[model samples]
Target chain A: MTTVLHSRLLNDVLRDILSPYDLPPVEDVTTRRQLARTLLSGQDNGSFNGLALAYAVVAFCTSTEDGATEVLAAVGDNADVLVLDGVRGGYLLLPCAQDQHVGLARALHDRLGSDVWMAVAWASRRDLASARATAEDVLRIASCRAPGVYELRNVLADFAVLRQPHVAERLARMIEPVVAQQPLLDSLRAFISEDGNRAAAARRLDIHRSTLDHRLRLVERLTGCRPTSPRALLTLSVALTAHSTPQVPLPRAY
Target chain B: MGRGQPVLFDVGRLLHEEFLAVYRAAAADADGWEDAAVSVARRVGSRLISAKVPVAQVVVALRSTDRLLTEAMLDDGGDARALAAAGTALAAELMSAFCAGDDDGLADALLAGSAPDGAAAVYTVALVRGALADRVVNAFRRHGPVLLATSGHLLLPVPEAAALPLCRDVCAELGGEVWFSVAERPAARVALARKEVDEIDALVTSLGRPPGVYRIDDMLFESAVLDTPEVRDELDKVVAPLLANPVLVQTVLALLEADGNRAVAVRKLFIHRSTIDYRLWQIEQLTGLSPVNPRDLALLGTAIGLSRTNALG
Candidate 1:
């Protein structure tokens, strides 16, 4: 079906799904995500011609019908496909096995070549209601990747919370006491970001593992939350997301 | 029954009837009558006050005769001039009333959580994005007679019947890109409803969810907590570790977004379940909070929300 046709159908399904929530029917992308979440929890449709696939991959690529068709064709008969429009260009949904993900993405890019640039993000019954939400994130992180098959995992680091203004303010303040100890904060950030991989975080920071440990201890002393602990790191990660945000402007005198 | 008392009674009765007639007539169609009515009332009310007429006595006299006066005015068959004059008398009596009953009614409704029987419903409108702010404000003004604003949100005190229509009109006029939230409280108490609307607005925004009119009950706990600076700061510390690795932070957020359903977080993040496990482990290792644990998950969810709120903004 055409992207518009699929989107309309999806919107109808979403509305039906969201009706229980009693939210005013505002047809916006954000609302769409909300509805999609409800569906992701297990709204069934025989139209996909399968009970469920291991994965649902979404792609934002060239708008041309031929480009989209070629991309879908490259996914082979193993998957069910749909295209959604009324957004940034067009979107493609291909539900397939995790095993087929890499091969399909590669084939599509190979066939479309430079004629189409593709950004892919995948979802599953476990977490994603639809690949629609992650497509943008994938597209954004796609910039750091060369033209080829790129899963969201490969470039997950590219998506930081600190990039938001309000968040950054809160985070900066949360760590304000320790912020002056630049080295310590830096070590903690690297350690957490590297998924607590001491060697990796040390390498990224160009510090010895022992020094990283020392800095981490300092972080513990300041925040009362050790850097190496999951619970503490979780808090630290949230605070770090704040760093990307632009400084909050003066509060408006309402 | 005394000779002088009888004459005085007749004059008072006639004046009271006249005042009631004008009031009923003007109320039937109040257009262009307020100025005349208020002026006449103020003149007469002040005069009576100056003449040592007790405000209570004047109000009681007006109240006792209101029904009879209204009946006479109705019998006049839409006589605008007489109606206008009666409105003036009524206004005078109203002014002389010992207290502002209507203001008191409003105050009662505003102060109470549940609206009193006659209180109108008030709503708080939050403008999330500024693009259609003017149009939305204008739309509310056009449809609702009373619009109150304080600090952040627009307070619309709408008649019961006007409530739904005003909401529909704004939605239709602005189109969907406009981000906003609407929640109703007692018209007098709409200012207090600001918290509800603000929470919903922040919740929806943090979730990267769509804009719509929402009730206070629609707000999610995670969204509400993250929206608060104090709570967000505390939660920020919990998730601060993952911030350096944006990807990992995103993973925790996805997990939190999925309510700690590892499989779901993996899907939202578009990563493998194995990857989700690894990240969850990393998160658990660094924070001593297991994604699988309900309490730990809630904490992580809060941190995720706090992060998303910032990132989305």
Candidate 2:
């Protein structure tokens, strides 16, 4: 028999046998392990021919108890979509064009609420594992920002910083003095939020323009980096983001 | 280096040790020196003021120490740039200490050219206050050093000829009322200059002159009136009737701010010219002080200023 025909026959037999009784939810540890084994077996035996096509792997975090089931339901009768449970959240494998990943993630994000953080990456059948890994990496880096849908492109800078922890550490050390001074740190944040407009930053901080200048000067004196200079400002800005982001590693992808 | 000045000696010793510490930290690890250097610099700066070291002497000492350290590092094939950078950080911290009123000597040194690169010898002192004091101070800093004193007062030193125009530009750019006083003083006597400016500021505040740069000479009339206790009461009585109507009061104040230009005052109030004309008429009928008459306008401006001050109090 052809591989596609054989896989279809096996899937139909399994569905017919399991359709008679309610199966355990995917949240059950044994059931999840069984499903993982079955998927791995399918990869080995070519039981799921759909896995051979290009797909978008999405990794997401959800606090709700039935998050796995909810995600599956959100994916909603899409024969090409596959869901896998992981330690913190779960993964969705959608066999679709690369350009559709963001729209799909956005739809999932809307369904899952703003509290969910999701990341997407594209891969072919053979690269599914690496795609899952990339999605998880993007998710970890983008988690520092507001929880929402993210892709590698959306978090390239943070991913760059995240990859070289030593550089991040040095950048973070540069702002250690600023981090200690609340008013100076607040001023820097306001200056950045105002897109480097001194008058607007002053208004935001409710301080005089001179006072903002003094505080920024103090920040430069402490960090050896001028907040007004483009290179130095980028260094300070990235350093602050890195410093505030938690450094813990994410759990391994399934 | 006398027994009476042990604190100064300690400051010198601490600065020396910290510079060495910074060099060693930099040599041992590139990233380790910043925190150690910054904390040590701040501590040494605070000690420099607490010891009451003369600002000029402190400048000389810091520069001498930096040169000596840099030269020693050069001889040893170490990073002289790191040592020099640490010194700059130390000086910046000391400037901060001076701004915080660590010592009068330090403040004087900052105003005067303790360092060869300090401000000019005969700079004019400007005391700036208001909602835009910070913006004005920052703008003034382009010309010279700006020292932020207690109670949000900014002491700026600029050339005498540049003072009025600079203040005008700041007020125009910032679009807010910033009351400031400018007094020409020798750099050595900025503290005294600040007091004189403060007095002029007080007199101007009492007279309720429109927000702009003021000199003591410009406020001679207001000063003469402020000296009499009954004059304020009399001035208050002159505009009290106009004050009862907030709209008329606003129109009179706007006219004064616009220098008796009704068109400009109408633009400021965002009202029709006829409305402003009617309001000014109402003000004149109520207070017997015509906004159109220069002398009457002056009296009305003073009354409004005193009334605003009283309301604030």
Candidate 3:
């Protein structure tokens, strides 16, 4: 039942994604449209990368052995991942981008059933989070829909953690202060985006550090929270993440 | 023939398409997308599996719809004007899912147990993914223990033949008796969810012994030495002296492995041939068996193999 809950949730997202036009988007039609576009772009790139990551992906054809002439190359060294089916059931080398490579793992799993052993390498910090999120998302959502599809037994986590709505609701509260104080909010956003360097923040805003400080103080006063406080910092961080995250078009759950 | 099962063992398409399809179906609901997807997936999967269609065919169908739905989900990210541009984000999700071996596309539904004959089993459901033969054979082989990855489980379309041999070999090596059956993909799955539906399990149990449909076998090594207690004791007595002296035992075993060839034995033990000779001579003195003798060499080799196997295990 709980598994089905995850399936249902995924269905809602799929429906909205498939039928983006169904949701009325008066406030941010452009925003909604961009959201839909990114998902498509991501899908295209994902398939290529997904193929690369699969425990059972297509091996390259031989166009190798000669450097200057060949339509295709079957060089093992250039391949993204190496899958080994030896030490009993199976094993796989997951070619993952440190920061840039995204969504390859989950796609591979969904494409294959659950009997996969993967060794993933994240190329960057950004990818680390996405990879981890993707792994989590698979566990949470895979079986929720297809009970016997693949063999991912009972390792699903809370999908709300990755769901934008839950993040939006929580973040909405956090962003209220920014909404309450527009100028200071914009300045702070830039400052944080620029990585908390007061000089950079001020330079971006064409203001003195003292002025930036004073504005930040105004923000603290308005929201009863200081930028330095852990809670405030967390809220700000989450807000930035939420802001940056693509709005996935999800249908209104009936 | 001993190796590949393409459609059934695809770990990727199984999750992606299924998850995506469910997501699409449930996305329209007010409940969380998580809830909606899970609900839809389970509902559809349950119906499809229970509908009596061959499990493999059903899997293949799920893969296509899953991919289509997921493409739609990722499509959400394409709208740059939306609250947040999600193309990159959704793309990232899709990619990561693939890497995670959750690519449950349309092909998987048609893997195991031939397509069942009936309209109910052939509900024109959304398609997901279909894996190639070679790829799946390798996937199952590489993923060692399904239990190691608690996050997910595995569904393999093992030929009643190959799997049985493997199970027998493993049981023999593992020093235990193990029994398994085809698990009636559709029934075992549903039954596993219930308190293990007895009738299905019973049917499986009965079928398990039938030499074909669902099968179970064992590999038991009968010991000639253990046929009689005196012979067993004699064998044990000889092993005890060697066990008490690991150095002499190892030296003797190494020498025997080399077939009494001192140079080979020395190389294997990574020791001087003179040291090996000395140990060999000491073993002879203690065991009262000449290292050069054929009877002693055979006995030493067998004993060493048994000892090493037991110790390692």
Which candidate has the top score in DockQ? 1
Candidate 3 DockQ, CA atoms: 0.00
DockQ of model 1, rounded to 2 decimals: 0.02
TM-score of every prediction relative to native: 0.31, 0.37, 0.27
| Counted clashes in each candidate structure | 43, 3, 187
DockQ scores of all models, one per candidate: 0.02, 0.00, 0.00
Candidate 1's residue-wise lDDT over B171-194, tens digit each? 767776666566666555555566
Candidate 1 yields a Cα-based lDDT of 0.51
If ranked by lDDT, best first, what sequence of candidates would result? 2, 1, 3
Evaluated at residue B147, the lDDT of candidate 3 is: 9
lDDT of 1 by residue, A1-254 (tens): 11111322354334334442343233444543333344344453423222233344455455355655565455433213433432223444444444455555565577664445455654554444434444454554453334566654333322333223444455556666777778877887677656767899999999799998888888876755556554456556555544432221111111
Tell me the spans in candidate 1 whose CA falls farther than 4 Å from its real position.
Answer: A1-254, B1-131, B137-152, B156-184, B199-237, B255-273, B292-298, B307-313
- TM-score leader: 2
Worst 10 residues of 2 chain A by lDDT: A1-10
